[model samples]
Target chain A: MSEQIVSDSVSAIKCTNCAAPLNILGGGRVSTVTCEYCHSVLDLNDNYAVLSKFEKVKRPLGPFKIGMRGNIKGVEWTIIGWVTYKTIEFSDEEWNEFFLYSPTHGYAWLVYEDGKISLSMKVRDFDLFSWKVKKPKTLFYKKGHYILDDESYMFYIDYVEGELNWVAKFGDKFTCWDYNGVGYRSLSIEKNINELEVFHTTKLNKKDIYSAFNLEYSSKSKTRKDETFSDDDESPSVFNINKIFFIMPLLLLILAFSSLFYSKTVYDTSYRTNQKENFSIDSSAFLTSIKISVSGVGTANNKLSLYKGDEKIFYIDKQKVFFIKKDIGKSWVSNAIAVTIYLKLDKGRYHFIGEKNPNQSITTVKIEQQVIRTNYLIYALILFVFLLSIPYFKERE
Target chain B: MTDGFTVEKSINCPQCGDTLPLYFKHVKLVQCLSCKSTIFLENEATRLAGDSSVLAPEISLIHLNVPFGYEHKSYLPLGKIRYSYGRGFWEEWWLKDSEGNEYWLSIDEGDFVLEQKVDSRYSRELFNTLNVGQVTFDNLIVTETGMATCEGFEGALPKTVTKGDTYLYTHLSGKDASLTTLELGKDGVETYLGKWISPFDIKKVG
Candidate 1:
């Protein structure tokens, strides 16, 4: 194959270890270039000298690759370098740093670990010098207070590939400290001797990363169902449920009040009798049915009858209570009785007759045409209390 | 000066007798490729020997002969300084445009910050009073990132900067990823105005 031209004086240079042709795309800015074929670290400053070599570590293929170009947040970035770093003390934990480069945005890092990805960038305008002197245990940024989450020795570089703007070699180590706040925001402090560098990172969703790169994403590659830092099993927001408890009762109360507008008193009257007396009324003028209530209290045997012009519709007999006492002990004996009745009558005249016993005690009879209405407010209040208790029980669990 | 164009001037290395190319006219110091000797440029060119205070070229990944564009203007790297504070180290590269305008490019890890020195009169007072966290400077609230003690020096520089020097740096963020830095060094205080630029935004020119 023909050689690929990188510049006027430089074409793709062959790797010293594997003789594989490698291109230094960062031009003069890149001092270190890694050969993909043999995993050899090549020194661009010294005519691509073999600075270091490492045995290739096998792993699953990630979605990103060196030299792949994609747009992130409207800026075009190219994956110029990648490094696999593992903790010195914790060998089981490891992460990959994909060095992204954009001429306008400079450099950014995409960190992938445990099937999760986060984008980290150097924060500018931070007052690190004063913060170091204060020796603050926490860092405040973007309305969040970040506390120290983890502190570990610098990660050892296990593998390196592609062109790097900075000089990086295998086995490079430094001390690192991490701070985490609410959600995905994190602050990482890397200390190399007396120098300290701080980086801010935010977790990115897989779908957003896929969309940004315009790549086809499938669930087959997703190994974990939960996020590294997210609390997926936590209860949902309780604000909506609390608000429902307040608004529902008010609505029920309004419905109960509105029912009052449709109710009317069709008839209201009462009758009282001392002796055998009968009363009658003509056919009703109203179209709807009429309702009547009868209440009476007496000391004699009373018989009350309701009829439509002598045709008895209903009748009730009340027996008088006898006040008889045997002198077994000094005690007073008496009995009191009262009765009430309700009836729904059609549009017709009605008669009420009251008969009293032949004694000095008189029987009194009372009747009414008013219908008994149901108290809906009482029913609504009971239902409202039940609905309000539901959330209280849910919160307890 | 045309955008993305670099004008080169050739001169003999005063220390080594080897011919060297000066990429920018305003560059005060140049390092010899053959002998790695630093040469100072002025009315009478003089060689700065035993100037171990110069930053290492590999530390900053800076190449003097290469031209890079920033903010639609092309600049050439001249020299760099290595600084350390606490347990980290960073490098600042001195750059000059074709028109002799000077700027500073700070590189820490993969981050690049481009800045221009401003009046240091007010910055001295800010350095004396300002603490960590957030403070308002020039009507903008900026956070104090850290302070560092200059660990050592390597390459040629524009001004007299010594190793072991300490300075306080603060940053103010702006809309659309713009940033400003306030540097309080041994030589009073200096305010730098610039934004973070991506490596892709900088194009190499021959």
Candidate 2:
């Protein structure tokens, strides 16, 4: 491929097999370049010879793209490559590894796994007095003691792209031993046929990584269903169930206040032996129905006549409605009788008159307006609370 | 063993006939001050080698004849040799600590390893069969095995390192991040025991 020798920042190197422009960001140390356009792995050390070709590979996801310049720690690095891998023991497990390059610091790795991002660098000063090969129960690194997380495992390369410092193919495999330590730090021992490298990794905060790349700061992290969180980087979750504990009670209080505001007394009057009372119904969304109650004793034949602007709607005669007499407390003796009438009145004034017979005994009369006759406010609150708990309990488990 | 250094002299370069002042101890090879040609000492005779090639010097942390601190101890670099491999190159600096002890500090990119020559009983047959990542009977893991050619030289060296000489080397890692490096050339296999040093620990001594 013919190209111009411009500055180090610009590259015109093209893929030999596909003729796609391959940027040489890794400089003279890069051994391979996988053409992102054609999925052809080209050996950079051997004049870009095609070494491997990936078929039917899907592009990986996440917030990283190639050639993004960002500062990690103190050194500025340009993302030169990206690779996707799946664990051989757990085929469903997958992650993306980005190769970062700095001229003075050489190459490093940034791994995105389980909604978390971590920086990985080669470590040769690992404290070894606390370690064994097969079943290392503990590891000491960066002065922190770490325990082996289960056991060592192997992984296979599922996809490859851009430039790498070594020759790698689509199906190349490697064995790795991982140990999680304190302070969001982890150490891994990676071994293949050609090299054995130990890496020290520290989990990066989302805010740091996003701001370094000039990205919008999103606090949520993507996690697997069975994944857990650590203390240092907090957590990256889709929804926080703890928020429901704060917001649900405030919402319930507002509904209860609305229910109370709807049940109100628009008009009230009393019956004194023989008298007539007048009331008005303006009619609103909250006050739609009007009710009248006649209170008396001994099943009197007392009655009240209701009218709207001289038009008689009906009469509410005293019925056998009795309140359980607390006056006796031994049995439900009828001490007072009340007859109620619910009327859907239009926008007009109304009047009522009650006539007491010579043998009739009428005590008092009351009238009220209501939006609904039966107050289902308590039942509605119970249903609302039950509906909100489903997601809360599912997230907790 | 000169705890304090001895008398130094100047040698005339055979290629350019220029006088070169020698300040380093046990000089086996030196570069002329004017011609930049590599010169070697064959017993009492001095011979001229090829022109010394210079690696990119802007990124190097240590300078020749300058004192640096490592692990709270001071050391001065007296010699440097650069070797180029297939992918990249590395450098080995000869250092003498304040207590008069000497070491070999190798730097590849940002990684540093400090070494010192050790007496060994391993035969040539055993060294030939070692490969990268192969564990030996002594439980030492061979981490790297490669061939590199001499690219440049400066100051003084104890071993003959004329420009453009190729050699094979192997690195074995043992307990506590300790390692042993073997350089096999016409001088046979020379073994050195060492450990990886955190580059941040090396600072310019006041």
Q: Residues A1-397, candidate 2, lDDT per residue (tens digit)?
A: 1112224564668889879888877755678888888999888777778888988367887677778778887777788889998999888899989988776566788888766788888878774423545446775565565667666899989988888878787778898878765446678888777666788887887668877866565444344521565424432121222344446656666756665566656666555466777876766443343343334443455666677777776564444221121121222123435544445556678777776754345446565665554345556556767766654454334
What is the C-alpha lDDT profile of model 1 across A160-232, one tens digit per residue? 8887766666777867877765445678878664346778886777667766666666665554533433422
* Highest-scoring model, DockQ: 2
Candidate 2: Cα lDDT at B78: 76
lDDT score of residue B125 within candidate 2 = 75
Provide chain B TM-scores across all predictions. Answer: 0.74, 0.85
Query: What lDDT tens digits, residue by residue, belong to model 2 across residues B163-201?
Result: 688988889888777889888788777889998876656
Pairs that collide in candidate 2 are: A221-A236
Once fitted onto the true fold, the runs of candidate 2 whose alpha carbons sit more than 4 angstroms away are: A1-12, A27-29, A87-93, A125-134, A150-154, A171-176, A191-196, A214-397, B1-23, B32-50, B56-58, B133-139
